[model samples]
Target chain A: MKNHFRLGLFIFITPVLLWLLLLIIVPHVELLLMSLHGKDDMGRTVWTLANYRNFFTEEIYWYTFVRTALYAVIVTILTFLVTFPVAFYITKIVSPRLSGFLTVLLLMPFWVSELVRVYGWMILLRESGVINHLLTSAGLLDAPVEMLYNDITMLMGLVYTSMLFMVVPLISSLEGMDDSLIEAAHDLGASPMTIFYRIIIPYAAPGITSGSIVVFMLALGNYLTPKLMGGKNSLWFTEQIYNEFIASFNWNQGAAFGFLLLALSSLIIWAGLKISKQQLGKALS
Target chain B: MAPVLDIQHLRKTFGDFIAVDTLNFQVEDGSFFSILGPSGCGKTTLLRMIAGFQQPTEGKLLIRGRDMSRVPPNRRPVNLVFQNLALFPMMNVRENIAFGLKRQGVGAPEISRRVDSLLERVHLSGYGNKDISQLSGGQKQRVAIARSLVLEPSLLLLDEPLGALDLKLREQMKIELKKLQADVGTTFMYITHDQSEALVMSDRVAVMHNGRFEQIDTPRNLYSNPATRFVAGFVGETNILPVRASSSAPLQVQTSFGLMLRATPVGNCQSDTLDLFIRPESIILTPAESHEDINLFPLTVQNILFDGSNTKLLATVGQSDHELLVALPQNQQFAHIGKGDTVPAGVHVDSCRCYPRGGS
Candidate 1:
């Protein structure tokens, strides 16, 4: 019986293990090898640290890396601030039917491709777009104002694209909270703000960590939104990696940048876990 | 002394369904008052209104002679120990107790002092640093009570706080809660669906049914002199027999089972059809030839339910086939009483109460 159980378990898990090993682990190992090598004078690949050193020596590369990290952090914080109340309202305040409807509304935008969605934002945000036309016609602006190709536009696109990821975790966590806890806080003479801080925030910490991690990773590695919205000034880290691999045909340099981006995301997530005092396992669950 | 919490004609309705209907009551200062009912009987709705969590559709709630119609829960001088004992999981025992004081903007030293003293009062002196999850069910219950009582609210509302505990723990906490209420001397408005908890813990209990209070009295009076059929059935174990008054001569009721019985009429029981409530323990079983003066009937015992001190004898009255429950007291004389034993059971007229059937 035990042997049969073991065979069944192994059979059930073999496909996932094979997929992970072949598709993810193997490629990452290949990239790691490629990142540590450079083309020699005769065009033969040889081991070197020059590819890794190039990132630190180039001022624009380092600046773009820091800018992307900072932008991702800002977007994560903004998404949290915007999504927490929306999640709370849906889970606790609204009727069940309305809450279900609102959840579907949040999910509706994800049905279309992320590329299509970013392009849609471009239409509404560009200088000659629908928003500018409406503003000028309504006498809100004398001329069409340039609303696209800026940091704000890039951040807006990042936040909008990553909203559903943040909200899902938050709603699941907030819905598990008993309403009586809020009432108990109120009864104990805690004001609304105190209740939110002392009870709701602490109870939803795992959800916050999980949501922030997802949003930050997506925003940091995002290529399409920043490319379409920020135009020339959008020097996101992923865009730099894309340029190294596709534009410049520097596979070794691109592989190094990919590892660096991976390291940066891991470091930030680790710091976030430390600061919030939440375990990654619990947060993900 | 004036009442601490006075609710007059308070009602709560959702669309067409009424949750609470014109609930009027006053909880005395330093008294443990419980609203006891089955689930969805509007007791919780009434308690929420008292705690200022929900607004009454009509009528006013007064706390310490001040109208609290506009007061929100946080502003009201009341705190609730939730049914689940909703202790803040993020805080330690001391922090949980000190939460209300901190919210009140009390000094740091004062907050610690009060938290320490409250912990001592709840018999959890050294558990200040212990996480909430580490505490057992009863300890958590005390911490919840301590958290609320530390606020020194005019009234403390306990919403079935012991409902989640196991049977043994629930029994233990009943006495603990009553003692805690006495030690704190805070007026408590407790709502629970458990009849035993209400009867054992509260100074007075209001039996509620169908969005209204059927009777509000001391536990003994409620058991002995219930005003409604719902109360008699809900409060304690009693045999309710359908009967009709032969005549209003102080007390005389004819049972529907073709047996004439005697009872003390309750309230304005002028109606012909009535409900006769006879406590099982009130019936006296004796040798066949020794019964005289009192209402006696020969019964054949069909079943003997032995439950320690609460044993009961189920029997058929005379030859009428009407089932009657008679409490078997713990005594040497009735030790041999078993199934199929024919004995004479005597029921005193005053031991039985008759209420007008389905009458308000």
Candidate 2:
């Protein structure tokens, strides 16, 4: 009976495994193959190591990559600062029904596509938009101000769009924790701030890791936000990949760029897992 | 000493649902008091109110005669060992024990000294760096106790602290807890659904039913003289026979055990319908032919069970379909008794407690 059940489960999972191989694994392999092939004038594929060499040697390529990574790091930090208190409030302080309603309100923006959401932010942040209009009318500014089409606007979009993802996991992890632990801490005479840093933060680490990884990955790959809000001169790396593949028609360079991004993300993920394991091991010990 | 804890009319309500209804009690200094009840009987809510995690809707909680109804849990000089032990999983045994001292801003050397002393006190010497999850159930329990006691709080509240332990371990810990209380000379207010656990360790037990305290007394009083039907049925084996007050002297109880029991009123309560409570062990079971001059009723034994030290006899008394559970010593007296045997059951009326029926 157990064998039959196992067989049935395997049969059900086979198609999904096949789909993952075809969609995810196959595309990754094709990218690796294209990265090994050099580009021609007619955009034909020719075998060479020039694309990889350029990625390693060029300071501009490295600069854009480093810049993109730093932006993601900043966004991750901002998201952490903004979302943690909100998650804590909803999970630990508020009534369940109210928390549920607030969570839904937070997630309501997710119903719209990222493209539309960025455009919406662009509309509000433009020089002639409501913010500048309000500022000028309130005598806070002499004329329409320039805030959009900069690094600040790009960062704002990234942080705002990813806030809910951070909150949802954090709330779950925080809520899953026993309320008695906090009471226990208080009973031991720990202050609220001490309790938050010592007990609550560590308890919610898994959620923090998950939320950060997701937000970091999205922020790292994001080209649209910077393009729409940061404008032409900012030059994020994912935009470089887009230009290489479509505008410049350099498949090998684009593939190389994509591979490097993958390697960087993988390294970060490995570091994250290592840190999580070490901390978790210490907690366990 | 006067009572270290005095809670008067402590009521807590959530919206329309009353969690605790006008609970009034006092804990004499350096005593083990237990609140014994089923789940949702407001025992935990009452404990939380005392701990200051919860504020009662009405009434006052006094610690050492100081009204602490509005005092926060952190400010209150009381500690609680949560049911799950709630040892900081991140910290080792020594760190967890030192947490309270650390919060009080004790110097590191003093903290180490105190933690080491407490570790020894709880018989956990050299387990300073042991992980919480790595400890056994009983060890965790000891760790929790050590952690709570290290603060030297005037009062300690334990919420079913032994509810998760195995039977033998629970029994062992019960003795250890009572000893710890005696050694520390602090008030312990414990909560548990286990009646035996309550009776074994508590200096006084308040039996809670619904949202009210049914009775508060010592273990002996609770078992030998339960004030209400709820208390009688909850604590131990009890046969509550429906009876009537024939007069003031002899109660007329048409029990399945036969005849009006010649019993006197236990208290001054004037009520017609009475409930005669009899513990199974209190009754004498003998063969019908050998019994003489006893308050005897002929019962046909339906089932006989040998339970190591005692023999349990399930029998039909008189013509009623009611079955009386008779416990007999598993010695030579009941060695020959088996199923389908007829026996005479006798009750010592003096030992019975008569209460007004349905007086809850």
Candidate 3:
């Protein structure tokens, strides 16, 4: 009986193991090798640190990398600030039916592909877009104002795209909280603000960490939204990586930038876990 | 002295359903008052209204002679010990106890002093630095009480705070809670569904049913003289017999088993159909022949339940299928009473209470 159980478990796990080995581990290993090598004088690939050094020496690359990280951080904070109240309302304030309806509405944006969604934002945010037309026609503006190809537009796109990821975790965490705790806090003479900060926020820390990590990673590695909405001024790190791999045919440079982005996201996630006093395993769960 | 909390005709309704129906009562200062009822009896709704968590659809609430209609929960001079003892998981024992004081803007030294003293009072003196999860169930309960009492609220509302403990712990905490209330001397309004908990801890208990108080009196009085059929069935173990009025006397009721019984009528029970409640312990077996006021009947014992100190004899009176529960005393005389024994049982006329059937 034990052998049969073991055989069933092996059969169930083999497909997943093969997929991970062939698709994820193998590609990452190739990237790691490519990132650590550079072209020799004879046009042969050889092991070198030149590709990694190039990123630090080039000011534009480093600046754009830091800028992308900072933008991702801002987008994460904005998404959290917006999603916290929304999640709380759906989970605590509304009835179950309304909560379900609101959740479905939140997920409606995901039905379309990311490329289509980014393009939809571009249509509304361009100079001759619907918003500018409304503003100019309504006498709010004398001329069409340039609303696209800026940091604000890029950040807006990032927040809008990553909202569902933040809300889902927050709703899960907030739902787990017993309503009696809030009442107990109020009974113990805690004001509304104190209750929010002391009880609600602490209870939702794991969700906040999990959501922020996801949003930050998505925003940092995002290519399509920044490209379409940010225009020429948008020098997001992923754009730089894309230029290296596809535009400039610099595979080694692109591979190095990919590793740097991974390192940066890992570092930020670790710091966030430390600051919130939450275990990574718990937060992810 | 004036009452600490006065509720006047308070009612709460959700559309057509009434959760609390015109509850009017006053809780005396420094007295342990409990509202005892089964679940869904509106006791929780009434307690929430008292704690300012729910607003009454009608009527007024007065706390210390001040109208409290507009007061929110945090602003009201009341605190609640939740059923689950909702201690903050992020705070340690000291922080949990000091939370209300800190919110009141008390000085740091004063906060620590009050928290330390409260810990001492609750018998958790050296457990200040321990996390909330580390403490046992009883310790957490004490911390929850201390956290509320430190605020010095005019009234403390305990919503079945011992319901989460095991049987042994619940019994132990009942005495512990009574002692704690006495030591603190705050007016306590406790709500619970357990009759034993209410009887053991409360100075006075209000038995509620269908969004109204069936009876409110001392535990002894409630057990001895229940005002309604619901109360008699709810407060303790009793044998309820459906009966109709008999022409023999004004208080005589004829049982369904064709036996005539007399009981002391409660209130103005003029209904033809009535209910007679006879407590198990009040029925005597093998009564003296000279006792003319006692109602005697022969019962055939079907089963003997031998619980230590609570042994009971399950028997049927006459040939009726209706079972009568009789308590056997812990004495040598009744030691040999077992199943299939036919014995004479007697209940005094004053020991049985009769109420009009279907009256709340």
**Number of backbone clashes in candidate 1:** 0
Query: Considering only N, C-alpha and C atoms within 3 Å, which residue pairs clash in candidate 2?
Result: none
Residues B123-185 of candidate 3 have per-residue lDDT tens digits of 999999999999998899999999999999899999999999999999999999999889889
Off by over 4 Å in 2: A1-63, A95-105, A128-146, A245-285, B250-252, B256-258, B286-294
Answer with 1 or 2, whichever has the higher DockQ: 1
Fnat of the models, one by one? 0.93, 0.82, 0.85
Question: Please, what are the lDDT tens digits per residue for candidate 2 over residues B1-360?
Answer: 547899888889999998899988899988999999999999999988888888889998889888897677888889999998888887899999998898899999999998999888889999998998899999999999899999998899999999899999998999998888888788899999999889989999999988899999999999988777789879988777787666674554555445666664665447877777778787787634433234666777888776778667787776667777878865677778777787677766665677776656
Give me the overall lDDT of model 2: 0.85
Worst 10 residues of 1 chain B by lDDT: B287-296
Model 3 per-residue lDDT tens digits across residues A30-129? 9999999999999998999998899999999999988988889999999999999999999999999999999999899989988998888878878899
What's the lDDT for residue B351 in model 2? 57
Q: TM-score of model 1's chain A, to 2 decimals? A: 0.97
Scored on chain A only, each candidate's TM-score is: 0.97, 0.92, 0.96
Itemize residue pairs with steric clashes in candidate 1: none
Candidate 2 vs candidate 3: which has greater DockQ? 3
lDDT of 1 by residue, B170-273 (tens): 99989988998898899888899999999998899999988999999999899888878788888888888999999787678888777787778877788889
Which segments of candidate 1 are over 4 A away from where they belong? A1-5, A40-44, A136-143, B287-293
